[model samples]
Target: MGKGKNKTHEPKNERQQRGANGHSARQNHKHMEMKYDKSEKMKFPVKLAMWDFDHCDPKRCSGKKLERLGLIKSLRVGQKFQGVVVSPNGQGVVCPNDLEIVEQHGASVVECSWARLEEVPFNKIGGKYERLLPYLVAANQVNYGRPWRLNCVEALAACFAIVGKMDWASELLSHFSWGLGFLDLNKELLEIYQRCTDADSVKKAEKEWLEKLEMETQERKSHTKKTDIWMMGNINRRGNGVQSDELESGEDSEQSGLENSEQPIEYDALGNAIHVDSVKSRIMLSGVSEDEESDFEENEKPVNYDSLGNLI
Candidate 1:
């Protein structure tokens, strides 16, 4: 009986220790929140919720991992989670690169299974505060170099980074081995995107990042010249490339000039170009009827104009 009592006491103590350890971990998570604190301190705006796009395997899934970490939760029993609901629709709010937008609607990442993306019911599960993350390169094993292919955690990390809580993103990602790798692959572009305040700015940053990436790729491929360089050379040889609109306008002007040139000009004996309108005006001023002017068609002579501004 003594031995049995001792054995029974062991698990209780063990369970207590385990509980203590869990409590410590929870405390650490709170400290992490403090560690990533901002001056304006828009706290980690998102309270995560899994949309469960497809039935995921209970053993091996990111959603399960997030549940283990206590990253997925809701404020109330049935209400949507604290953050905005992420959506792929182009109309959603842009990820808050600037502090003002963040305050209005902290970001959200739509949880979807990449393997069965088409199967997800995006329209049905979406919420009111629909937000779209800006262009981001995925560095996961499944979707490296792929834009907008982030898994649940990666999507949250991106929102954290965009809202200027990069440390928070890094800490959350530290839970997995490849988490840091994602940051490394996207480090250059993410830094640039974080600085952008709006969607248009984010787009410009994406272009700049792609251009730099292409240049680096070219440099890696045996020092070959870039297509842009060839284009520049051609432009320099051409002096100036006429814009399409300007070319069209010039063509129209030339065509009208050609049509006008068809009208025969009667030059004055003094070798001056006679104005057709002036001839008609003088004819009208001198009271020469259009009937009287119809007689000579073959040998048309220029009408002489006097200094008095009348046809002589």
Candidate 2:
């Protein structure tokens, strides 16, 4: 017997072929036809929102769908939690996609048109922990192939991916026509980015990925993004917590009754908009009511929860 090797030798070409096949298989995994689990229903931990500045089509918007599914529960601006505000304008590269970040701070996404970002009512809502999601391509009907034009749920799903929670993200997006396509586009980069902890690290990974995917990206004037110019806490002419085209069509104008008055919107330290007049039964300080006890009683005991905002 030959003073032998412990195992039979594979031909070099065969070994290389096997390695290539394995890699190809893995790459293909990201592109596999996305399957939806019909029975899969989940309540993701992060709070999602859309400022609804553009007055997104009620019929087609993914955020509205998420809200209907109860996956995106509405929380009043005054209600308390450590939250991350996703802004395309944020100078900080850090985002809420990391597990520690999500566990420590809940995530929120604002939906505004990338083209006319000036229209979003930034001053209406309060935000402290600002975050900027790195460049990612759009996969929706209106702005397909465009980067940074994500719908609300898709943006939140990316945050979910950053925190390494893919299942919940996928489930929310499964209802959209191009939902799976987003995950496919960002899987590898997200896997890389989620490992980063801070803003600088996240930005580093983002820069690398952007360079790699440089060809697929489209460039527009930086002016299109008003992330730097807008100031928070400066309520616009609308004066309420929102300003949209819907409002211009005389929706909230009558209810606000402030078309002539020039008083600035008053906000508490926590950023709650304080109306001079008692809010009507239809409008509430808390979430919209489907029940009769519509008044938001300040004396109602707050739910006792741990520091993590988890029920004790």
Candidate 3:
């Protein structure tokens, strides 16, 4: 009976050892295959891709896949892209494999990639991309409350760099919110401004930027003013107290003056003759004719006499 039990246990042990060896062999085979496949080309699509610089999860990036594609290592912040109208969804200048679509808006979509796009002139994109740089920088800084601060200064610096006009940048920086992370930039711009050899040229560029900023500000103000006027009109139509009081006060003052003038006048002293004459002259100057003045005098009545018997 003992011999029979040993035989059974021996077979079971041998089977378990065989299973373990098979598993080890498979793992070794897989490792060998990986070593051999090291030179294999990475898999990536060849087409245009879109990316949202504003929000992208970096962990989702497939580094091996991106390296396989002939994509640049970096992309400009605030870059915009559109799918080719003719090419199907993600097929065009930007390879689609390097990015995954995260969001869609109208004709455009957002994707994620570390690949850089070809540099294009700001004017080539109709200044749309140029306008986005400020906001993008602000977003990158993670301080939206002062979005325009550094952005405005950076914009001025960029403009100056492009135009070769330092004074223009300085002047533009002056108008920006100084307290909003702009002190260092402002100082740098001032240094540039001081080094400017062509003040006139810089001045012209400064004027242009100022005019552009002013125009934008004016448009915003006009829109705000229109809204305020609409609100005020609505309130006035509903008879708001402030508007009502202003109107009421004006009417009351006019009526009071008229009533006082209509009351009788009596001189207690001869010295008041100049004052009365001056009043008469003022009325005549206001277009009351001599005949009208005489009518006014005749219509006027004496005041009540005082206890001293003198005319009050």
Candidate 4:
């Protein structure tokens, strides 16, 4: 009986000790998690932020993804930020000259549906430095290849790229699978933007690029028109059983002859015309009249078959 009691007590003590160890282990794990989370939240070069309106898919929202990845922090609707705010209605364009301001204050972009821009509280989201991104092509899945339709991540990346923070931009983009594509899509334009020393210079560069694009588009359309005309001419020649080269020469000769010959004031479908050879006009019947005599006299010799009723 004594041995049985001692064995039972020893087992209970071991069980209690194991329970204490498990609790301490759990506490340590939770502490490490909290420490890790803090580090993740603090990990970033420049303070990147977003004003998420929750108008997008949580899975596809780049802003939310950045927030999850600890690359960007989220702000409330009326939160005031003293940094470069990229807004569609911004008065000035972002440029490399804003680098100092961005580094000191940070950069932020509004995360909302482009189709619902009106619903966004723009006035409430105050910022000391509100600016617009110059012409840039989106590389995200939602608005890929579209101009000025960047999502949160792409917009933030553009802000970094324009402010001469390529590393920070690259870092933000690296979190996304299609991030590098944004840089590639806007490479030329971004280069032009970065070279700008001020916002006005950036605007000027954008204007020049737009003009060049328009000229190129117009030239392409003009070339297409000329091609269509050439094809039509070829098809017409084929219908006439005439080789294209021969048809060209024949048409040129015919045109030159028509230009050199006397033009008719009035003509029929069969190219018949009445020339005014008299000083005064004469009223004539439609058939077998003085007009017929004139036509026979001009085109052929008079046939003498009235007396014999035979050929002459």
Candidate 5:
């Protein structure tokens, strides 16, 4: 009995040892797999072309060509791209893998994605002046040698205005022109200045547009009034509230009286002349005195007016 018990305990201990070893091995394997996955996700640098499209006519190329040139791509959200990576002295760009890309080609790293470039329409790409204008303005201040920046600044201002970003357009004008002159005195900058000045002109033009809108509104109101009059006439004819025949009869009677007599005759809907034979008799019947009436009229006069002439 003792030998059988010992044999059973020895086998049980071996099984427990095996189970523990298997569990540890599985845990180790999982940890290694997680580390490997993390490393694989990290981006390594690669060499890419930096093309200049500042003067390139986009009209001459297909969409595919634009993509190849890296001109069309914009930055993707949460994606790392390239930039100039400027140092204290403003000179850098050692490893291609070390760099990230940005929208502007001027940056050191390839900063945009093929997706962003392809997503935006070709026509709209050049019209994104608001996005590019501030950089141009800043670059102009840093390096005036680049005459193209001026043109870019102007284009951006105009683009902003066209897109209904008047505040931005105004800001660009105020910053570049320094408040006094429209033209940048730099001869090289003139080309760009001419293009951008239109943004300010656009704001002024909005006033004329508003005046046109007002005129249109007035014309619409007049048309609506005429329609209302016709509707009212029809309503009267249909006897909705009053009869048109009665109104017409009254007008006819007044015209006949005017032709026959020198005195003017005003008739009610029943065609009876509204003749006030005695104004004093009516006032007396109402128990109102002339002096009280005069006092009331004087009190009702507007005090703010210089005189009756001023009221008119």
Candidate 6:
């Protein structure tokens, strides 16, 4: 009897130990999972928000993507916020002077299509300060290489960069593959805008940059024109089987002899024809005589020209 009793107790103890080991393992796994969750949680540096108008494709919309990643918060239409509002009709441009307001109140952007900008109820949008972003190139695939066509994240990033929150800007843009490239594409322009102290300075900087761009474009066009002219001249000379020196000499002789040659018949201001006779050293009327010209009436018909500049 004692041996049998001891055997029964041994089995019970073994079962109990096994149950305890299994529970401990399960608890250890649960703890590990919780620890991982904490580590993986993303912490945004600033309180970034936006008002999405659902005007873009869900898959392609940067604002929605950021919201899914918990990087940005979305507000309803006409919702009130004390942050700096990025609007197309902003009162002024975002600059370093607004850094304090941005840091204190955070920043928010209006997410809508550039086409439907007029449909947006700007008056209902609430914000302590409404500001426009300075000129910045888009890095998103859709509007890549286009200026002032930034998506929500890009606009926010630009504001952050202008306010001296470069790390924040970088972090905001880091989510997208082409995001960081935006800063690189507009590196010089951004740097110039970032250095400005206020809206006035930013405006001045933008003006200067625009002027420089315009000048460069004009220079490029002039260079292209000169190149085209030279190529045409060269082709003409080659086609005529003439050397450059010979062509120049021929042109000079032709110009000098032109004064002595009989000139072609031409029209005067009154539509009367005048014939030039170099030998007689006098002008003669041909198409209409002076008395007949006075009696002529002006034609009221519309004149048309063909593509080749011939009267049609």
Checking candidate 1 for backbone clashes, the offending pairs are: none
lDDT of 3 by residue, 101-130 (tens): 201211122222222222222222221111
Give one digit per residue, the lDDT tens place, for model 2 in 113-139: 466666554555436666677777778
Query: What is candidate 1's lDDT per residue for 1-312, written digit by digit as tens?
Result: 111111122345542233211443345345334433431243334445555432344344554465456555311112343345555643543544444544564544544455655655455555565666667777766676798777767877776777677886786678777888878877876787777777677777777877887899967652332222221212221223433344333443222232266443332333232335555632332334555444432257546543233456
Query: Listing every candidate in turn, what is its Cα RMSD in Å to the true structure after a full C-alpha superposition?
Result: 22.4, 24.7, 26.2, 21.2, 26.7, 20.4
TM-score of 3: 0.19
Give the per-residue lDDT digits (tens) of candidate 6, residues 1-312. 111111122355542232211333245335434433432367665567776665676678887677667666555445667878888979889999989988887888887778888767777775878998878889999999898889999999999899888898899899899999998998898889889999999989998988998999998876564443332222231122444454344453222232245665333343222334431221222223444433442444323233223444
lDDT of 3 at 236: 31
Ranking by TM-score: 4, 6, 2, 1, 5, 3
Residue-level error in angstroms, candidate 4, position 261: 28
Model 1 residue 96 CA deviation (Å) reads 3.7
Q: Estimate every model's Cα lDDT from 0 to 1.
A: 0.51, 0.52, 0.31, 0.65, 0.31, 0.65
Q: What is candidate 3's CA lDDT for residue 24?
A: 34
Q: Number of clashes in model 1?
A: 0
TM-score of each: 0.49, 0.50, 0.19, 0.64, 0.21, 0.64
Please list all clashing residue pairs in model 2, or write none if there are none.
Answer: 89-227, 97-162, 97-163
Could you give candidate 5's per-residue lDDT for residues 1-312 as a string of tens digits? 111111122355543232211333345235324433432332111111222221223332221132233322222122222433211112221122211222232221122222234432233112111122211222333334443233323333333333334454354445443311323333232233333334344333444545775899998976564443332213332212434444444443322333366533233222223222443432332234657535755787412211111321
Query: Model 6: which residue pairs collide?
Result: none
lDDT of 4: 0.65
Q: Against the true structure, candidate 5 has what lDDT?
A: 0.31
